[model samples]
Target: MASSHPRVLAIVLAGGEGKRLMPLTAQRAKPAVPFGGIYRLVDFALSNIINSHYLHVIVLTQYKSHSLDRHISKTWRMSALLGNYVSSVPAQQRVGKHWYLGSADAIHQSLNIIEDERPDIVVVVGADHVYRMDFSQMVDAHIESGARATVSAIRQPIALADQFGVIDVDPQDPTRIREFLEKPVNPVGLPDSPTEVLASMGNYVFDADALVEAVTKDAANPDSRHDMGGDIIPAFVDEGTAGVYDMIRNEVPGATDRDRYYWRDVGTIDAYFDANKDLIAVQPVFNLYNEDWPLYTGYTGLPPAKFVHAGPGRLGHAADSIVSPGVLVSGATVAGSILSPGVHLHSWATLTDSVVMDGVQVHRHAQVHRAILDKNVVVDERARIGVDHEEDRARGFTVTDSGITVVPKGSHVA
Candidate 1:
């Protein structure tokens, strides 16, 4: 039995041209960036959708969406085409040369398609964040509270609150949002800390009728920014029907406790780097190996990751690191690193606290530390990277002030 669950649908926004991720977003959408060795950035959202029992989903895509399109087709083929279960909605040129004028416009343009489905609830989301949540719970909360809309939220550090849409809610009633501001000039303070602020995760749940009305009305507002957080939320907040859901501490099955739910917005290079580093942490905040709440994506039938001459007495060794299938460490030394499939670390190379994506070849005697090497990149022999921030940038690579170098995909080092 499918159970008497609500007819919920997910609308994932993958349209934004991620200028911050740079070189990485040069050829692919932000959501299509490779993550956690085996999955794309979009997989995290899709996994949450399926796991949350929102069988019906439509990914709204634009702006360099070819890679995202191919990825969705390849991995999400299990979805039905004839039904309202699952599909990807790439922005077609039907509306003239102007592509997705804004996030609100994307939905406004797709209003007809959404209307055809007649879903009970529409779960709006961004494809860039990395986290997991059961949408069913949010739906349950929405129904019980009888709110017009609900925004997912999390507590951000005091210093970083200005960078996000700060939310002010009654601490007593965590569900009732008192005020909402989009990247406010002076963020509201948190109870735990006089300086910290609670920020919106940019995820939302709307009653089908409420969503249709809001999107239509917002579209007509000539001065509106055509963004949900900027225009729609504030409009509803004035009516006092908008609610808040603490995604960081939502009492979902897999995510509970104040500190368990890990949510990250990888909108900037620093944020992206921090999120990737979270995966390699001891007892990672985001649990990828949880079988009960398994993540889903299109599977590529690659051979199992292997380690030849591993363990003691071998020229190469990996300690406390995840070596994906098809990786050959050879005589290299890797510590606390993530080596994606088909990575070749030449003999005598050393990799520490780094993420080596698929098909990256580290030449002999080279050292890579606290760096992210994109797919198909080759580091020449004895070439030093991530050692000096100034030197790495001179070589056409990005080096964080902390000395973490980022080599873009298919980059050729001279």
Candidate 2:
């Protein structure tokens, strides 16, 4: 039985130093990094929470959080008249002089927010994933199951189980979590499906009392990692109060079958690039045009994208790409790419299978292939990036093992 509109407080964890996505994470927090032409990674989490009508939300930030804080403050303003707010709470060393040790410790330090809000249930989610979920339904499942903590789980291949924290479900009770294993070398498959396992999505709903208690206990343990996945959740599993909410059952209003269960943890350069590419598909794996549940962000009031120079050998064309507002593809050929707001591609420049972020300038005759250019990057005339691995490395640009070149923010490539 679902509780009739229980007081819910959502806490978005946005503090991780994304070491894998360097240069992009060089100046900004991972969640604050630009995504999908127009939005930040944290926007997805905040959008879902607000779309689900969970109005009272606080974003927890640490570790180079200035950009993240600015984005949240400017983009996520809710009406104060309705007593609803979407605010970013930075780590203030409330417990002591130390910064946040881990995710659990971050929350433990900011328990004052929870206490002040006095919410019945807390919705804790990560800020670096691309997905849409009806968390209200998860909250209902949490209340109905009578679990102290409920983890949102998605089915992943057993072979790739070592990459994620796998959840072992009780054979007798599908909702009950039998064990929580963090990236185990040899993982157990699901009870019904031997080839698939329930992988934790790092999103959780906790009974307010249970959450506070678990974090408090973990803080006292000397050997604890002070992590929600490593310490707090395991304690709930031991108490038999940890439940699993299958993400497959989550139904959004305008979601299609193709993108119904689409969730991507864009943790690495390759994964992040792939996730953005997923949006530009003919039939996108993750549809962003769903008007029923719109992805909210701070919109720059700019005019529509413009294309010019239709003469021979100077066609300003963008095929199979997402071109955001204020982008001018002047005599350039953009294919299989994303041109973010205010990007200007000059004559004869070719951008293919790449992501060029806001305010970037790809000068005349420059070519960018299979690369990610961060904000305000200036590619000088005829400059070549992502073409030669040796040259890219020699230029001090970060090149991935998969050969994706990453040009950092505000860089001028000559």
Candidate 3:
């Protein structure tokens, strides 16, 4: 019994500093960081919204958002004649002369956009997650349940509950959220599955009036964190007006059984690297080639990738990898890696289990393994990376605890 169509406005939160993802985030915001060779992290969220037929979108941005702003402006252009737009709204300090204190504070400050649009339901989502979801289904469930706020919940193992905001549901009402716990050490398991807990996906569908009232009240509280997951959600849970939308129940077109519920929060270096590596698998857990629910981004006009030269001990070949456009694998042996656009590999260069970003030049006999080379990095002849942690750290490069060496942007290896 849901309405045929409701006035929906999508708000994407893209303001996190992403301090945990350093070096990669040094030059741009987390959402602006390139992913899967061509798309940015924010592209996943925006694609989902657009694919769901929600065209009126506003991205709230802060903390080094120049690249993020430019991406949205250039790529997400919608026809203004049709009343569609994808705008990036920065912190304007409309209420005070200070920056956004938290997520709720961000929305509280940008009330003007919401008021101007006058949407009946506001769908707010985070910018740094990789997932595909048809949010229109969640909206229907929210309307049917008559909840003031609806949070998208994903089933995560109980052992990993400490990593997220766990949701405790009422025993009698499976849809009603009993409590909201932030990174709980001992989380309550679901009724049917003892080893699984419902974790908030940081996506919410809010009744427009409820959202306005919650954020407005939270703004006046002196001790509140004013975060969406930390403050606004807990307030609605206290009022028994918050419902949970099971992500497992939401169906997206062209989703395989192996990738139906695929979602990753690439918040750290290892996590980001692992997520990128996930694409090279024979059967990726998160498939990128699903054309039915395609992931959209800015199109580059680069030519197709090329592989040249076939000499003794110097074969230009790549196995189990994704090589983007304009990449030239010249007499290089690439295995289990991702080569971004415009990467040029010289003769005898071997890259294994690594991510080479755009415009990188790997010289002859250089060996790269389990490493990330940022944009415009040049590896000198026979230079070794991800081979020695001590040497890498001494050379001012970052070496994660997992031993993933990262060469920052425009660095030359010798």
All models: lDDT? 0.79, 0.93, 0.93
Q: Which runs of model 2 end up more than 4 angstroms from their true locations?
A: 1-3, 191-193
- Model 2: per-residue Cα lDDT over 127-194, one tens digit each: 99999999999999999999999999999889878877899888899899999998889887776898
- The true-versus-predicted C-alpha distance at residue 55 of model 1, in Å, is 0.9
| Cα misplacement distance, residue 40 of candidate 3 (Å) | 0.5
lDDT of 3 by residue, 1-414 (tens): 124589999999999889988999998889998888888999999999999999999999998999899999999978999989999999998999999999999999999899999999999999999999999999999998999999999988898788788998888998999999988998778889999988999999999989999999999999999899889999999999999999988899999888899998898999899999878788898899999999999877899999998699998999999999999999999998998999999999999999989899999999999999999999999999998888889999999999999999999999
lDDT of 3 at 405: 96
Best by TM-score: 2
Candidate 1 lDDT by residue in tens digits, 192-258: 7887788888889888888889988887878988887788888888888898887754554554342
TM-score of every model versus the real structure: 0.92, 0.98, 0.97
lDDT of 3 at 237: 98
lDDT of 2 at 209: 84
RMSD of 1: 2.9
